[model samples]
Target: MKKLFLSTITIFILIACSSAPTKKDEIKTVKVNAAIGEIEGLIEEDVYLFKGIPFAQPPVGELRWKAPRKLAPVSETIKAFSHKSKCTQPKENEFILDRGVTEGGEDCLYLNIFVPKGNVDISKNNYPIMFWIHGGSNIWGTGNSYDFSKLAESQKVVVITINYRLGPMGWFSSSHLRNTSEGDDRSSNFGHLDIIAALEWVQENGNSFGGDPTNVTIFGESAGGHNVLVLLATKKARGLFHKAISQSGYVSSFSEQFASEESELSSAKVFQDDIRFLTEDQQIADYLRDMPIKEVFQRYKQADESHLYSISPISIRDDIVIPKEGIYKALEDVDPSVVVVAGTNKDELNLWYLRSKYFYQTALNLGRNLKRSEENLKSWIKYRSNIWRFTGAEEPLRRMSKSNQNLYSFRFDWDEEASTILGDYPLFLGAAHGLEIPFISGDYSLVPAYARPLVFPNESKEGREYLSNLMMQYWANIAKYGDPNTFVQDHRWNKFRIQNQNYLRLDSPEYIQMVNDPVDADEMLKTLESDSTLELKERCLIGWIAEMNFVEEMRGDPPFDFCSEYTSIDLLKLRRLTEGRD
Candidate 1:
């Protein structure tokens, strides 16, 4: 019976693949003479898509760990029909919602372009350009994961998505390597340099695709959001983009000394330990450059297994890619005309908290006791997510508003999932991290298949569509006019000022409005201490995780040391032992 089932599934998959529309038969081909070369794209449902167009040479072999090199002009026609391989990174766990390809290659420096077929005339050369940066903690993500066709066609703008190097290959920092390199290649932030190179390519080729290079807007979520903030802080990206939006981005950067050789846990020190068995001399730079891609990934895995490096450091302050003063101080000195939008979800951490065995449990007979866990779960998410909002969105926008008056802030609170036998997704996931991606892209299919029905049930389709449309309008308006409120007249999205501290509350039509809600460390600490639902150790654990998410300087000294009695690792161990996972 099992063999029969497997055979039936295989046959079904074959039938499905055979019946699907082929590109040559169904898609209408279109050609454009970009600066790099003549390229062939496809038009499907009034949206022209150019996929897997190389903007930079592949960073492989001798080019590994170096800044991306620009592509030379080509007279030949380039076929851009399908996406290329994503950048090299670790395998993703099966259960995560944001999962992508299991394996990626080093030869992944490509980009995709989407243009509206009728709304924007290609001959006119005046549409706004929106550059998307995918976010997977800067370790795992590809430009191919997102589909911006609907967004492009509906908003009448040009959308570009590019793949960059990931993991250790993208942001490694070593003094040995730096001494041998020159110019921008000496910078430790290679991933950021890849973004800048893509932007330069857009400036050179955007006119051919009807996009206005001067009106470019760079936006991203999570690590991409973090990169957006990094670009704003660095002078290297000054004239590349005119507007920036960082959704759920935090201002955390490692000093050059810390990233290189300040401590045993530094990336450089950990890498040196990995290669010590292979070599012992001063020619480490040459040895690393010649190392095979598989071996480099193997060494990274071995180092991670030993816990020599607790977390990967991105956007290093090398005084080349990033300024020495750091992201916040540098934000105040950015161009005053540069518009900025920064925001966070109402319950950002619930995505992780809902899956944890430490806080939730299940039984065979009765379902998980939602009533018993409601208070504790809500309290933990409230305090920690508040800190995330304050550090990620409020603080950065407040500082930037000092110089740039064209600033906007928002809090996404659209949690209207239908209750199902599987679970209460509205309570568990809420407006969690990365949920806003679908709304912005107008790609509701991006929602995980397993939770799609419950999250976007037919009964709630009207509300979900309304909210998604509003978000897409706001995003496109910002790219076109440097203000989200230009076309969204009914909801006058206020500018973020230090005094008013007002932010748009993005929710269903009935709930969406501009509101004032400011968060501070002192208030968060006070609320944590006053809450009686949690024990002393529980409060400490929650406080520690929240504070540790941001940089050291932004984390003001709390009134009480929550981790004084028991460290966060200790609590994790205890939870595992109690849950019988030990």
Candidate 2:
């Protein structure tokens, strides 16, 4: 039943820091002349850390729902000592641990930089710049949540993480705002524009921090991954980044008309329905621009609760920012020189599956029904996760391979979790969504302290450390040389192509290898239909999930012939009933 709400409720808490590194009482600070101003940073744990450097003027008041504007140069040395406020977002569920700050102010267009503390000759050997984008379904996340010190210090690379507008503040399409806006100001993707502004800042000031701006790599997971795909497709982002890595990203985009007018749940319709007093287009635009930050957020929250939409209509197909042809079509015409890597976890949907009552059941004192639920859980996860991989990773790479041959794919399958008295964490969680983040960041402490023992027990430390180090090496290598196999000797990761579809299977040392198998949505659905292990209800459920997750073109008429008997709403109600939510 929870699967029905997966679109709206599935929040990808991709990156987080358990705690900041302990700082020495004696302050050790470094100064660099950036494009914005003379910036002062501190040296911590063998890395030079600069925090909360504004890349753009705050999108407040009249700037709301408008494109991010570049910050003017400052003469005084900007003290980048602490992170700025996180972008405004709703408080996450209490069950989610270490989700940085839940609520923040609107003045959040800031970025942090982590550089290797060294005296390298910049003219001779500048490190590659790695820009990170965080994920929270594009609605709830703060770049301040991530600490890239380890990645920077160990990899000898410069890493920058930035915060952008979230939810309705970041993306909104309305005729009122559109008519009043001009040029890039007309773009609904303000968050995307913020990223571009940050990149432009890096291009101008990276050299001051011993980073090679010409070798910038943009990488992120989930919604961040989705943005990376958008940058790859959008012509406006050309030359801003040299390489891209999208971890578990899908190329989902909405038409401008759909976002603004066509649907009853469109951003414009929702706003109009809520604020009926404003008659003139100019009056509406002025009122929205002058609206209080808290009021704007309240309206967005109310609309979200009433409509039950998963994410706001983000990444609109605006001809200026995104091509009218859409993300997939634009990707096919991307710059061939820009190298790309796309991948997904082996059990991408297990995180949600374990939480759903349809797959798992928990009692008051007696724990979850693991033994009875194991078979059905595995079956459902296998097919549903494959559908995720197909839509998010495989299909996008297949389409992108048409123009850019320098593409790679991967599947993270590290599931060495401990079996605790409460339940089998390995069987339930496996290599679930966003689990690969710790590996990439080289921060095993990201696993919550309470669940640390169960998720990463002491016995699994050796293999865990090995895989984490390997994944970091792969990511660093890609940033430096646009290939994960450049420095790593463990395995030769091959390029992904339509004819010879190759992808790296990331796991423990023994299980890591290059896989060449390729399967499409139709093949997967056919296999699911023929599997006698799944009952008719199970098949229908899987079909419904596929229909929801898959792109419009990939969705079949009814997904499954048998599913025709049940409407989508009917299945949703059934799921709700099973979960005791209805």
Candidate 3:
């Protein structure tokens, strides 16, 4: 019976594959001339889909740690149906798509395009372009992970997703590497450079796919959102994207000295002095570059002392891509013409608190020791979420709007009909990190199979669909015009200002509405400051994670001062709780 069931499933899959539509009569293959060659893409679900189009030469061999080079132009025609390998990343245990399903390796600098088919001629229609940057703490995730067909077809826009380098390979920096190089090659944030290259590709080739290169809106979630902020402030990224949206993006600062122990843990110092530094700086650079990608990844993983958070793949304020004062001060220098949409989810930290082994063990320890694990965890999640709002959304908007830039802020609070069969879904996950992705994409599969019902429960399908449609329209409208309220007639998304500080509060049942000072910034701060149950050490940990990246400019008014009352042993045990060895 088991064999029969397996045979039946295989046959069903074969039948489904065979019956699926292919480009045949109605625009089977859409041909367009790109930078390198004339590319042929297929039409799927009324949209032209192009996958695995390389924007930069593969960063392999001696080119490993160096900046990405532009691909030379070619006249040859190439098929862009299949996606290329995802960049080398740490293994995921939850959903490992088969090797046959998608290829992944170091040679993975590529972009995918999805354009809705229009009855009008390609040259006649200028659809707004939405460029998506996936977030995985800059260590994992790929462009292929998202399916933009729903977003493209429904919104009648062109959506593009690109993969940049990850982990040490993407952002590794060293004194030796910098001194040995000249020009922009001396810059450390290779991942940011890769994103610039991709955007450059879009500027050159996006119009071929019925996209308006002049009106492109760059948007991303988490690290991707963080990248958007960097691009907004980056002089090199000027004129690349007209509008930006940073979903749950934070302005974490990086240390100035790339290799010194005084600096925060960086990819360049992943080995922590285990690797020898030879006589010649060039020799050291070669040695580090020539090391196997897997070995490099493993070394960085072992040396990861950032506790539960992922902060290694950081953009350094190397006075090149990033300004010396970091992203906040960089915002002051940002072109006032460039607008922004920035916000965070209601329970942003719950995702980390619920899934991280470190947090879980810490909760267990609290349960065993103080019998206050659950409450502490809840308090920590709420405190961290509040901090994220202040740092990631409110503070950034406050600074950016000061420069006379038309900015908008939002707080995603849509959590409805969540399933709790596996655990307390409402309390544990809520509307956490990356939860908004599925809603924006209208792809519930992005959530884990077991968690799909909870993320988009059947009971809340009406409200969920309404919220998704509203988001799609708002985002597409923002891309088309500078304002999200352009097409949204009924809903008025007020502009963020220094005094009013108005923001859109997104909810499921109520859809979206404009309000002022919805998040009590002062009250939230007081809650953290006055909470007696949370020790100073725990408060410090929450603040550090909330800060995301530590830049030199923030050394004066740091989040939390050193709590001399706590001993090293007390912190060591806490560290063990975070490391999951408790």
Checking candidate 3 for backbone clashes, the offending pairs are 23-28, 85-103, 252-549, 253-549, 253-550, 253-551, 419-454
Q: State how far residue 435 of model 3 sits from its true place (Å).
A: 0.8
**Residue lDDT tens for model 1, 146-212:** 7888889899899999889877788888877787788887888999999999999999999888899
TM-score of each model, in listed order: 0.90, 0.91, 0.85
**Which residue runs does candidate 3 get wrong by more than 4 Å?**
1-27, 93-103, 119-124, 258-277, 305-313, 356-377, 419-421, 518-525, 532-540, 543-563, 568-582
Candidate 1 residue spans exceeding 4 A from truth: 1-26, 96-102, 119-123, 262-265, 277-282, 362-372, 550-562, 571-582
The order of the candidates by TM-score, greatest first, is 2, 1, 3
Deviation from truth (RMSD, Å), model 2? 3.9
Candidate 3, backbone clash total = 7
lDDT of 2 by residue, 301-343 (tens): 5655553222467778878788888888888888999999999
Q: lDDT (CA) for every model shown?
A: 0.75, 0.76, 0.70
Cα lDDT tens digits, model 3, 74-130, are 767877877887787766433321111222477999999988888544545578889
Error of 3 at 549 (Å): 7.0
Per-prediction backbone clash count: 0, 1, 7
Evaluate residue 144 in candidate 1 and report its C-alpha lDDT on the 0 to 100 scale.
Answer: 76
Q: Rank the candidates by lDDT, best first.
A: 2, 1, 3
